[model samples]
Target chain A: MKILVCVSKSPDTTSKIAFTDGNTKFDEAGVQWIINPYDEWYALVRAIELKEKDPATVIHLVTVGLPDCDPIIRKALALGGDEAIRVNTDSSDSYYIAAQIAEVAKKGAYDLIFTGKETIDYNGSSIGGMVAELVDAPYVSLATLFELNGTTASITREIEGGEEVCEVSLPVVVSCQKGISEQRIPNMRGIMAARTKPLQVVEPASIETLTSIVNYELPPAKAGVKLVSPDNVAELVRLLHEEAKAI
Target chain B: MSVLIFVDQTEGHIKKASFEALTYGAKVADQLGTTAEALVLGTVNDDLAALGKYGVKKVHQVANETLNHVDTQLYAKVIAEAVTASGANVVVFSHNQTGKAVSARVAARLKAGIVAGASSLPDTSNGFVVRKPVFSGKAYANVSINSPIKVISLNPNSYKTVAGEGTAEVVALNVAVDASKIKITAVNKVVGEVPLTEADIVVSGGRGLKGPENWGVLLDLAKELHAATACSRPVGDAHWRPHHEHVGQTGVQVAPNLYIALGISGAIQHLAGVNRSKVIVVINKDPEAPFFKAADYGIVGDLFEVVPKLTEEIRKMKASA
Candidate 1:
């Protein structure tokens, strides 16, 4: 089985958010970037676990970003991916990114395509479905569990109040989240092995973007917390009803 | 062309989020100087005309049993047909589980520009610009959609659902529904519990409460408050709670009217999901916990002591009222 895992770079969970260029650009000055947690922890890890169960399986990592994102791609390889591919482009648009990835998947003809349900950064869980449409394949989103069968795979995806179990054949797109698999850290041997893995960079096809960022801003700073002592717990309830009107 | 809103319903009951979408779509339609209409896929027992209170001028109903449950492909086909038949210039969705699953496919089918997790009405003064949260609510991005046909999925709890004094004309839409390629084996569920997505108030706990055995304390509080129960990602990871109750960047992103968090440190990821709540209250033993900064109210004390007392206070207050 050949699985293609989509990866993206996101600001570290603890990094303080700041924007540059008059709030038009994300300030990378003091930010630490890591492979998006959803991609690394759920999608990629689940694919690697499937590969571990079958020696014939191969996992490939793909990302659409600037060359600066290669280190993150390499780290994905160190974790367990057999190879890495970078679609050279700016990922400012989700549809354009999906088209580029779809073009790559059409050429590679991967049996399964994996992506995080939504990127931790953009939080737009659209690409997998877009790519699935572009490639004329089935798409499943928010998958929390996986069980593969011959030629077809049985998948379980989260719904409003429960889970829906479905069976789809190969050459499908799946957007995964937590509970699909456990996260794995790269050991010294894996890191050394990743150094020798194939890292390919390809140009993005001339795909037109339907959306563009006209501006940027930050959420209003939470006006500091209202404190009520533990002994004044009843007062908290009073404030909730009278002041906050939350209840 | 009219602005079409997908009014999502489950077992004949229109979801609260869908009402938000209708209100949002109506406002957007008024902005564009067009009519606002709704499209529902399956048969419903509720009075479809009542939806007009949200400003929808019409409700388009497709009486199909296959759509009782969400089938992404089937939904995409029907909605695309509705868009064409109604000549809808723009489509709106709630951006919940069903909307998140189907909106993209509809966009793909129609070759339209799509924006998910939209938090504000579009600034159509210059084309169509939408503002949405990015970096897990840590930041916001304003995107411009140039496509004549556009798809937008509104984030739940972001838009206000207001009613207007009006009546809608219910129209039956005829469209060919396609057979589904996938088969659903079974649906696993936890009955008699409020779905986290639709809960107006939520009570969540974290590692500070210590273990799964202590969940009853918070659950009791949640029961008294008539709220849903939730937990931090770490608690879910430790298997102390079911993964579905986990709310964070990688888990469920909820925005209730009132979110009362206990014992959870405010990690950026955790803050990403719950920051959209109308009011946030954090209770923890540590005074300096990061969650306090984002909370509307903070209580520094043991949750074990504070929660039981808080629950008792609520019970007495309710009895008196």
Candidate 2:
């Protein structure tokens, strides 16, 4: 089985979000970039699980970004992807990223495709569905767990009140979330093997832009805190009813 | 032209979010100078025609036993076909879990431009541009779709469903139902006293409640308000509450009108999920807790002292009302 895992590099969640160019663009200075946690922990780990089940199985990690993304791609390779593909293009809108992935996925003839539920940066879960649409395959999203045997795959996904169990044929796309698999750390052997693994960079296919960010702005700063004495419970209630209007 | 709205139903009952979607679709139809129609799959006990109170002119009933359960792949095919057959240029869905899956697939099948988690009506001012939350709830983005057909998934609790007096014309669609290939193995429901997503007012306790034993005060407050109960990730991880009741970036997303946080520091991850709420109230012992920053109102006092008093006041207010 050939599986493709798509991931991105995003600012570590701890980074204090700031913007430059008069708040027109995100300030990347002094910020550490990490493999998007969702993609690495859930999506990539599950892909590794699939490969473990079949030694001959091949997993291709794909990302669209500058050459700097190669380290993150290599990190995913260490995590258990057999090979890596870097589309030599700075990641743009979700539409363009989906288009790039669809181009590679179509030619590779992957039986299954995997992606994190959403990138920490964009938080757009639209890519997997759009790629499924572009490739004309079934799309299942937010899968909590999945199992594959032969040509069929069964998935468990969380819904509003309960959960749904679904079965789909091969040649499908799934966006994974937590509960799919435990996060894996790369061992010494895997880390050494990843350096020797084949890493290919291909030109990006034509992408039609659909949307652009006009500007980026941080959320309004939180208001100052209020303190009330623990003994003054009635005062707190009064404030809630009159000032907070929350009672 | 017609507008097709996907009615979300479970266990033979339609969800409140679907009603908002139906109302939004009806308004979009009015904007286009067309009639709004509904497409229902499962067995709904409510009077379908009465949905016209929300501006639906017709409700297309597809009472197929196979559709009693939602299969997104199959439902996508059926809804896409319904849009084509009904000659509808616009398709609408509630941006909930089920709607999120099917809307994107239907849009792909129809090759229509799609927007999910829409907060308001289309621009309709000139071309079609829908505003949606981006980067969680921190910001907004406007997407323009020049395609002939448009698909929108409305965010729950974002729009109020306005009622107008009218009766809908019920029309049965004769589309062939395909037996689902997927089988439901087992359903493990959370069995909550109050489902968090559907709750109007939520009272959530965090690590600040100190320990599970002290949780009684929080539950008492929730009960007094007839509100649903929730917890932060740590509280749920500690088994103080069921995992399903955990709300944050990694758990369920909610947008209740009123969200009360007790003994919780507002982490960015937690804020991302509930920031869309209309009003937020934070109660904590420490005045400098981060949650107070995002709170519309904050009280600095020991929750043990303040929560019981607040509950008493609300109970008295309710009794007097």
Candidate 3:
């Protein structure tokens, strides 16, 4: 089996967000980044698990970003990806990014393509479907449970009120979330091995971005908490009912 | 060309977020000088025309019993067909679980540019630009989709739903359901509880509650508020709570109207999941707990005393009223 898993970089959850150039660019001056948890923990880890189950399976990691994304690609490699491909481009447009991935998938004839259910940064979850559409393949998203059997794959996804289980064939694309697999930690040996693994960079195909960021703003600041004495519990109830009106 | 809204339903009743989508679609239609229409895949028990209060002029019902349950591919195919048949230039969906599952597929089938997690209505005044939350609600992105057909999945609770006195025309849409390529073998449901995704208010607990035995304190508070219950990832990882009830970056991301965190030290991942909530109340014994930074209200007291007292107060408020 030939599988391709997509990964991206996201700011560490605790990173304080700030923008530069009059709030037009994300301030990365003192921010720490990590491989998006969904991509690394769920999609890529599940693919690695599949490879572990079958020795003949080959797993490839892919990402579309500027050269700064190399470290994240290396992290995926250390996590058990056999090879890495970086599509050199700005991931500003969902369709454009999906097109680049579709191009790679078409050329490689990968049997399965995986992406995080959505990027933590953009939260779009748009690329996988567009890629599936561009490549004329079936798309299964938000898959929590997956099992591979010969040529058929049983996938379980979360719906509104319940879970829906389905079966599909290979050559399909999936956007996975939690419950697909437990996150794996790369060992010291794997980290050393990743340094030797090959990572190929391909120039991006020119595609137009349908969307652009015109501006960036933060949520309005919340008011200071109304601290009531523990003895004054009645006032707290009154405040919740009349002022907050949350109940 | 009109704006088409997908009114997601369960057991023949429309989901609350779908009403918000209807309002959003209708407002978008008004922006473009077009009409807004809604399409439901299966038969619903509610009076469909009553949805006109949200500004929708018409409701299109597929009336298929088979579609009562969600089939992502099937719904995408059906909605794509409905978009074509209705001459809709824009398709709107609430970016809830249903929208997350199927909207992109519909966008793919139509080759439409989709912007999910939209926080506001489009600015069609300048070629259809929409603003949405990004970076896990830390920043906003103003995206423009220059497509003949546009798909947008509005984030739940982002757009306030307005109801007006109006009536809609109910019409039946005709479409053939394709034989599903994938078969559904079973459906495991979380019954008799408010789903975390759709809850208006959420009351969550953490390891500070001591153990699973003390979960009743949080559950009691949750019941008093008519809110769903959730837990931090540590509580879930330790099996103190079910995984579905877990809310964090690794768990479910929710944006309820009010989120009350009891005994949870606010981690960034947990905040990312619930920060989009309209109002947040944090109760913890530790004044230095990180969750207080993000909370709109904070009570530095033992939850063992605070939780029961709060629940009792709510119960008293209910009795007096």
True contacts kept of each: 0.76, 0.33, 0.57
DockQ scores of all models, one per candidate: 0.76, 0.41, 0.60
Name the better of 1 and 2 by DockQ. 1
TM-score of chain A of each: 0.97, 0.95, 0.95
Per-residue lDDT over A192-239 for candidate 2, one digit per residue giving the tens place of the 0 to 100 score: 999989989999897655554545545555565455566665665666
True contacts kept of 3: 0.57
lDDT of 3 by residue, B199-268 (tens): 9899999989989999998898888888989999999988999877889887888998889999999988
Report the Cα lDDT for residue A156, model 3: 91
| Candidate achieving higher DockQ, 1 or 3 | 1
Q: Give the winner by TM-score: 1 or 2.
A: 1
What residue runs in model 1 are displaced by over 4 Å at the alpha carbon?
none
Tens digit per residue, CA lDDT, model 3, A1-247? 9999988888887788888888878889988889999999999999999998998999988888889999988889999999999998885667778889888889889989999988888888787777776787777888899999997889998876567788888878888988899999999999999999999999998766656676678888777666666666677778777888877
Residue ranges of candidate 2 with Cα displaced over 4 Å: A16-31, A66-68, A89-96, A134-138, A148-152, A166-171, A185-192, A206-247
- Runs in model 3 deviating more than 4 A are none
Evaluate residue A127 in candidate 3 and report its C-alpha lDDT on the 0 to 100 scale: 75
DockQ category of candidate 1: medium
Work out the TM-score per prediction: 0.97, 0.89, 0.96
lDDT by residue for model 2 (B117-205), tens: 78878877868877777667776666666568888888888888888899999988888877665666666555656667867789999
Report the C-alpha lDDT of model 1 over B199-307, residue by residue, as the tens digit: 9899999999899998989999999988988999899989999999999877899989999999999888898888778899999999889999999988999999999
